[model samples]
Each structure stands twice: as C-alpha cells, then as structure tokens.
Target: MSRIPTRHLGRYLLQGQLPRKGCLASSNYTPRGSCRVAASCSCSRCLQPFSPQATRAVHVSTSSAASPADTPIIPLRKKLKDEAKQLKKESRKNKAQKGSAQTVDGWELTVGIEIHAQLNTSRKLFSPAATSFNDEPNSHVALFDLSIPGSQPLFQPQTLIPALRAALALNCDIQPVSRFDRKHYFWWDQPSGYQITQYYEPLARNGSITLLARDGIAPEDGDSVTVGIQQIQLEQDTAKTLAQPGDARWLDFNRVGVPLIEIITRPEIHHPRTAAVLVRKIQLLLNAVDACVSGMETGGLRADVNVSVRRTGDTATGRLGTRTEVKNLSTIKAVEDAIIAERDRQIAQIEAGGSVVGETRGWTLGSKQTRRLRGKEGEVDYRYMPDPDLGPLLISEDLVRHIKESVAHLPDRELDELVDRYGVSAKDAVSLMALDNGARIEYFYNVVGGLGKRLREAEGRTPQQPLDLELDPDLKKYAPLAANWILHEFGRLVTDRSSPQDDETAFEITPEGQCARVPVASLSELLFHLHQKKITGKVAKELLLALYHGNVGEAGGVTAAIDAHDLWFHELSEEEYGALVESALEGEDRVLKEFGGNKKTYPQGKLMYLVGKMLRLGPTERIDPVNAEKAMRSRIEELCGTSA
Candidate 1:
C-alpha cells in the first residue's frame, strides 16, 4: 500500500503505509485507491472518510449463471448519456430564463478572472515616499519597501476607498470584515520577502459583468453571454525590474506598494476571443467608473490566462483537465497566441496517449510558445495568516449602499439599453460606445436635444434662427440625425488622439488627469460645428485636423470656411455635372428628340449625376436633388417645345 499526506481543507492527514516514525520516505508516495471497490470500502486507511452524506447510486453489473469470469465489463456510456441529457435540458432552460452562452470546443466556457489592476494612488502600501511610475530607481523607495531594519508599517486609507468604489461598481458583495496577509515569495523587485494580500477575507465577492457581443443581437434573439464574477479584492503591487543588455537585473521601487484590485471571475470563459473581448469590456467598465486609467498596454491592467483543454464530455459532471497558468500576457493578440499554443500542446500530448501535467508557464512572444515556469506539486504553503500590522477592516452595509449609488453607469450597459429601449441599431450604438470617446456620444445627445428646444422657441418668434442652437428642443427630437452626423461627418473632423502624429493636423494628446488621454472638448467642438452647419463636413475635417495639430484660428468664421470651400468645389461640380448633362443632350439627340418625337424613357442617370454633383459641393447645404432635377427637366421640356 502507498501513503500520501494531503491537506483536506485546513487539516493534514497521514494515511496508509508508514516507515519509521521519523522517516518521511513512506508518506511521499502517490495516493493509491481503485475507483470500483473504494466506493463501498470502509478501511479509512486508504479512503479519507466523509461525513454521513446522502448516498448516490454506485452502478454495478451482475453477470448471469454462465461463466462469470467471461462476463464483459459494461461501458459507462449510459452514465455519460444521462448527464449530457441533463446538461442539454438545463442549458435550454437557462437559455429561456437568462440567455444562451457562447461555447467553444463543444463546452461552455466559464471564465473566472482575477484582474490585478494597479491603482493610481500617491504612496506605497506601507511607505511614505511618493509613488509614481517613471521616478528614478530606488528614489521613491521608502525604508519599508526596501525592507530595511527599524522601518515600521503604516496603512493608507486613500487607496482603500477607490478600491471600494471599484468593488461596488462591479456589483460585488462587499464583505463586512476584511484583512491582509503576506504572500511568501522572493523576487529582485520584491525586496520584501513576501507580498501583502488578502487570503481568507477578501474585500468583496460574488460580482457579475455582462458584455455585449457584436452584431445585430436583439433581446429576443436570446443569444447573449453573461460572465459571472467571483470577487474583486484589494492588494499591493510589487516593484518594477529592468534588465540591461549586459548587466544584472535592476530593480525600481517606484511602483512598489501601489494599491491594486484583483477582479476574479467565475470560469465562464471558453473561447479565447470571447475572453479577450471580456477583458476589453472590463477595461471600459473600469474607465467608465473612473476606477482605473486607460492603460492596458502599460501594465495598468494585466492578464494571467489560465488555460486547460479537457475531453468534450468531462465538464458536465465536474471533471476537469490539468490546467496551465500562462503568465505575463499583455496584448489580446498574445492571448490568442497563448490559447492556440496551449491547446495544441494539450491536444498533441493527449493524442500521444500521455496525461497532461498541471503547472505554471510563461509565453514567448517571439516563438509563440509556452514554456514551463514552476509547478505547484505539493500545494504551496504561503503560510497565509492575517497581517499583524494591519487590523481588521469593517465595511458597513451603509458604506456599500452609498458606493453602489455613486458608481457611474457603464458605457456598454448604456449602449445595450439604447439599442433595446431607444431602437438604436446595434452597429451604431456599438460605434458610439466601444471607442474611448464616449463623451462624443453625450455631446451628440446634448446638441440634438438642444436643437429641439430651439425649434420650439422658433415657433413663436418672427424671423427666428434655424433649428440648430445650444438650447434647441428640436435637436432632441432629431436624435437619429444627430447620431448620423456625429458618426459620419463629425467623427471625421476630430483627430483620434490615439494616433495623433499620423495626421499632421491632429492635436498632441496627453493623458488627462491620469485618466483618458483624448480630449472630450475637441469632440464637443466638432459636434457643435456640425450641428450649426457653419463649416461643410469636408472643411470641418480639415479644420479639426489643423486644430488637432495645434492650429486654433488661422481662418475666419466657420461659415467663411464653408463658403470658401464651396467655391473650391464649385467649378469642379459645374464642369463635371454640366458636361454630363450637355453631352447627354447633344450626343444623344434622340433624348432631345424624345420629347419632340413622342418617345419615353428620359435619361434619368444623366440627370441624377448633375444633382449629386451639386450636393457634393457642401455637406451643410442640404440642397434637395429631387427639386433640382425637377427644375432641370422643366427647362428641357420648354427648350424642346421651342425648337420643335
């Protein structure tokens, strides 16, 4: 017999064979037990006894009176079929009640993510030095981060409150009592032997985030995925390390002690792409709530992708495969790469009839492969006891309720509601919200709403202005028009601050107040110019590009630019359109002869080109092509009558 010492919950058990009392050799072997007979075994030597739990049927087959040794072993196919049927039934029920989920590899992907987002706080966890990202090496290091002798510990409440807000925003269950513990580890950046983290009592738990998938998915379509969130806890981040080409790894203490919130999810993710999309949604949510800065690329938000490939039928009955944790994946592309590589690795191993090993690994972007880093073979003993320096934190129900009410509505949810309630198309709604420039959407609504007010005020006034003003009510009624202008014409005018230098005219965008980098005011101005139609859409784009490139006002009023560009496009319009109409009338004398010869089929294409050319002269003009065509057709009819 073999004995394996294992930890069940918090208790340690020494089972099976033993050598000398002082010897550790005998207890180290793999635990041995057969699945068949162990179901009824009461030895307690091999089986760790369970509490008198309710019994589940232990299936067995009875051989007939014929040769019993020749009896065939029954396959477990029936058991598998029953479970699959139950899963299908449950899935259908859930689809009707909640919604259907996006599945990958024939199994629904349940993703539980613990996002360790670094907070933009001022000081370290236990230090007094100013915490900043790009400070000199060790300059921001306090004695506590340095792990120096005689350095006592202190807590900062400023970091804690923002984390509280984040928890509430994610709809997490805030725990009444929470405390920190030391996570034992050794690293160059971590001068302290252990990292301070929450073990038993996290700050929050049981949260959820619903991500809207792309395409025209109506509420009745019933094909949406809602990922379950497990928890979001506050912890401290470690230091930064820089390695020189020929030098040893250098450590920077500037980032040490920064407050971080780890957002954990239920294993509700299956597809790698869906996982990436979820991360993007979380990033948007955090930004919408002002909980974190928009910097997923700069280590502000990082991902530790845990991937495992199990048999298609295993997950239904709680059977799981050996999982590998891929660390240090920064980009969504890297995530896809990791998933593909890991899936291939698992599939190849299984095809070779080998069992997969559970371990931690690191991704190599260059070769696109995952290499083993470490294994949690015997379970890690972080010795996780509550931190003696920090006392218990009591979060009251009132405090949680307050945070909940204050949490800003997320853009994704708003987009969804807009699509469902306001009849906004999924495509247009997605365009307005998916980008970081949500303020543009807000300004659009404002301008459109203001237009409606102005229209109402004009109803009673003589010689009133056009229905486009700061306080217009008609604009509110024309929200779709506002959406179209913003999405098409107005958006073109504002340079995407994300790629400013690409265009010579775009303004230099910098991070705003440690939040979004783009300027919301720029979008507001563009929308304002569009609503007033002072500048044509084309000229507005040029002006916006120039403004983005730091050009304020070299030209006169916006109407002047519109008038100026109208001339620039005027001659081209006349030449192209007049030539088309004249050529049609002159070359096809038959068309001219049509009205005189009593023939049908007027040259509609030629007439349309003339009208289209006129409209292209300016976006703000709103000239009616139908009316123009009507005037042209009447002149042609009169000219034919006179010639005849």
Candidate 2:
C-alpha cells in the first residue's frame, strides 16, 4: 500500500475489492496488524471513540430489544412476580416468627358424604319380628338381630325393592353381581360385632344426582351441580345406643338388623351451601320415594360429610385442595359452620407455607372449629371382606324387572309430568311434589281426570288431543283451581291436624306412608261428595282433620265431623235465599228494561256472588245463597222479554 498521506494511518481504505488502508484515525496504530484497535481509543476532549487529525466515517450501532443483563437468571417477568409473592409470604412468616401473627389462605377442605336411609320393609332384615321405629327396646329384635349363638340371616325380597328403586332413581347403573361384606367397626350398639355392608360389590355405581341450591331450578341450569355417587349398598342398622355419660352405654336392640340403604358420594362438594343443598336433595329423594322417614333434626337418617382443601394450581391440573372429613353433621347449620372453619384453617396453613394434615375431625358446636380425631385412611385399610355366613344375594332378572315395574311412578318424573301436563307452574308443581303424601299425586290426577271426563260427556265431545287441561273445555278452567285446593288448602289440613306418631308410642306413620294407610275407597267417597258440592270447602277441611286425627268407622269418620261441625247445612233450603236471588235479578232493571227490556245486560256475576254469600251462612238462621241465585238466574233467562 502506498503511504498515500501521512494523515492516513491505521485506517482501512476501500479499494476495488481488496482491503486498502484508510486515513489514520489513531496516531499510534499500525495497518499490518489484526483489526484490533486500541482498547483505550477516544477523542481527546470528548473522551469517546475518535482519533486526532482523522476524519473517520462511523456506523452507529443500534441497541437490541433485549440483553443478557436485562434477561433474568431464568427468563420473563412471571418469575419476578412469583418471587415477589414468595418474598411477601416469607415476610409474613418472619413477622409471625417475631411474635406478630399474619393470616393467609392455607389448608383446603375436601368432603365426602355418606347418607344412610332406613329401607321400607314389612319385617326386619334378619329377623321374624316387625320392623318399627320407636318400639320398646328389644321388642322388635329377633334372635338373629340379637346375634344369639348360631343364628343366621334370612333375606327379605320386599326390603330390596326400595333400595333398587333408590338406585335407579339416582341414575345409577345397577350391578348384576353385587355381594355383601362384613365391615368391622366396633360400637356398643353393634350386636353382631360387624356391620353387614357391600365394599367389593355395591348395588349401584357410577351415578350422579343434580342438586339445586334453592328449589325450582331446572335440571340443565348450570346453577345446578352434579354430585357423584360412589356407591349405594344395602346394609343392616346397628341398635340404638343410649349413653349415660359416666355410666355405661345402654344398648337398645330394637333397630338392630333393620335394613338400611347407604349412599356414598364422591368428593365433589366444594362449598358449604352446596353441601347443605346436597344433603337436602338426598333427604327429599328418600322422602319422595317413601324409602326413609328422614328427620334431619333427629338421627332417623344421618349424614357423614368429609371435607378437605389444597392450594390453587398446586397440581398441574388443579383439583380441590386436600380435605378433612366432617362426620355425623346432623344439622344443616352445623355442616355450614364445619365447612367454613375447615376452609379457613386450610387456607391459613397454605398461606403460612406450612403443609396441612388430612384427618377426620369432629366439629364442636360451641367452638365452631374442628379438632383432629384420627389420621386419614383409605378404603382398603377398612379390611372389608365378604360375609362368610351369608351367601351371595342372587336376584333373578325377572325379579329385578318386576320390582322396577312395580313402582309405576317415580316422583321425579311425576313431578315433571305434573308441570307439563297440568299446565301447572314449576313452583306449584314443586310444592305438589314436596307433599309428604305420595298418594296426593295420584289423588290429584284422579280428581282432574275424573272431572274432565264428566264434563266431556256432558258436552257430547271427546277430550282434546294431548289432553291439555288449560285448553280442554271441561277441565281447562278447573285444573289449576283443583291443584291449588289440593296443594294448599288440603295440604294444610293434612299437616296441621295429623298426629306425627301413633298413640302407643312416639313413632308416627310417615306422611307418605299415611297415604298408603288410608283406605282408597274412603278417600274416593270423600272426594266424590265434595265434587258434587254436597260439602263446602270449610266442611271438607274439618272432615279431613277428623280423618287425620284417627277418627275411623263409616259413621264416625270425617263425614261425622262435617255433620257435627258444619254451620251452613241449615242454609241449604232457606226460603229467603231464593227471594234474595230473585230480588238481585229484578233489581237489575237497567238490563231487562234497557235491552228492548232484554236480559242481555243481566248482572249475572253480582247475582252469583250474592248467592255464594247466602250459601256460606249457617243453616239455623241462614239463607241458601247458592240455591236462591240459581233459581233467580233460571227464572230471569226464561222471561219472554229477555234474549233467549
């Protein structure tokens, strides 16, 4: 390279396609060396990269979007957020360590529920004696139930039907090969030393029931949640244990060997309200099917709820936090309190960076928090085995189908049908379905159906297609009216007047069971008289009350009460009643005199109202408003001056 100018040194000059020396930017640099410039190169005054006496072209470098310094040791700001959160948590812990407490979300509660219902039976499961609640101790206990030496169980086919119905009602798949097992759990009341249950083979499996927090919700509404049924099995109930605190626990064996159907739900409930609602649903179902005399306030039917909780996103696919069991929660309020306490406790542990222990805890009514009882154990640890003494229950296919057919009506389905067919609102239908008397549903159908048929015959026409009560000429007007009376007025009579238990003991017949106890012929006779307007609604209420109070015998029944108590029977044929109705028609002079003196503008409604008022008066000093109004209307319409 020619030393073009003394000023050009240590700088590359662009030549055709070869490297050429450029003007010298650094006075102390040489050209033949590698492209390394002086590390300390700078403009003399500015102290930046420059050389004296050299006009060098510079390519300004742009900064990158990121840098190694800017990037975290890992990458992204999520890590920073997480670290900050962790640091805050640690600070809280340190504060707690410094004698100041900090609260946070910690342990999660998990819950599983086991619901037991007494099966409807004619005789005790393993006994010849009767199966009755509230009976004297040992009264209903057979030798087998008492677990006397060498005694054995005798299967009852009738007892199994209710259990099967329950399983099907829950949408469970009935297992063809379910077997019974002996579950060992010691209690003072367990005469047999073991509970006969089904662990390996359950009667039902893989089922779910929809639960609505409040009533009247549609099944498809997301507000309704599904609760999974782990299994439903038939078992024998233990005897009642009456405890005396410091004294010995007295065993009352009357309930021993009574058939029980146990329903175990999977751990799906997350909140307290959901738990309460689930319990109510199960109880209602049992009541609806007449399977159990469930008294939530009492222990006739009991619920065991297990609860637990865990950190959110603790798992890759998050499940609920680990839970603890809240066992034997009899009251809905108690269940609510237990869930709240457990949830708070779990969240606190997790937030404190401490692990929560899963265990069975009993809820204290006064303290409102659960105390640990025993460590959580899995099902296999229960050591369930087949009962060696009892052979496998072989229910024939015919038997299963026949049992299914026997229960022609399912409450849930009937409830829906009532809503759709009768044109009844959902809420009204729910109330009808909630009636403790299962027969009321049938009674309602018969009342409406029979009345509609009579009306159709009077009109000389067949009932309309699809038989909509609202549209049918005979029934459209009265179906809802009848439903209201049956659901409300009649229901009140049944509830307020009926004794809860029989006279011999405190055990009363179940409302649904009571319906079965009533002779069908007697009920039909009562309804027929009422439909003929032979009795007023007031008398009907008294009659029903008398019937509910156990007054029986053809002459001594409700009809007698109606006779003795009715104040309006004397008004049935008052001479003044007819005069009042006729006066009401004549007083409408405007109608008869105005319509070319035609009766087209007749005050028919006012006349009927007056008639009804008179009919309501007591017979002794009363007038028959109904008969008066009817006579007046008939006479007015027959007048030649009136429109035909």
Best by lDDT: 2
User: In candidate 1, how many Å is residue 100 off?
Assistant: 18
Against the hidden true structure, what lDDT does model 2 obtain? 0.63
TM-scores, in order shown?
Answer: 0.64, 0.56
Model 1 TM-score, all chains together? 0.64
lDDT of 1 by residue, 140-180 (tens): 77788777887766877667776877787777888999888
Strongest candidate by TM-score: 1
lDDT (tens digit, per residue) of candidate 2 on 1-644: 55455334312232112222342443435445224344443434323354566454432222312443464354335667889999999999976643311112333345678888777776877667788777677777788887789888887777878888788777787888778898876667887778888888888898898875245332223467788998999898888878888887888888888888889999876566667667766776776666775456657677777766665455355666566776767765676667767767777676789877768878777565778888876766567889887777766677667766755566556666666667666666666655443445556666666566655655567555426644664353556655776677655654554355543332223443334334434454455445556665566555655555556556655456555656334444445655555555545565444434434455556546545644444342344344565665555556534533
Off by over 4 Å in 1: 1-111, 214-222, 364-368, 376-381, 416-536, 550-557, 563-644
Computed on alpha carbons, the lDDT of every model, listed in order, comes to 0.61, 0.63
Q: Tell me the lDDT of candidate 1.
A: 0.61
Once superposed on the true structure, which residue ranges of model 2 sit more than 4 Å away at CA? 1-110, 212-223, 244-248, 286-300, 318-320, 331-341, 348-355, 363-381, 406-408, 437-477, 481-644
**Cα error, candidate 2, residue 104 (Å):** 13
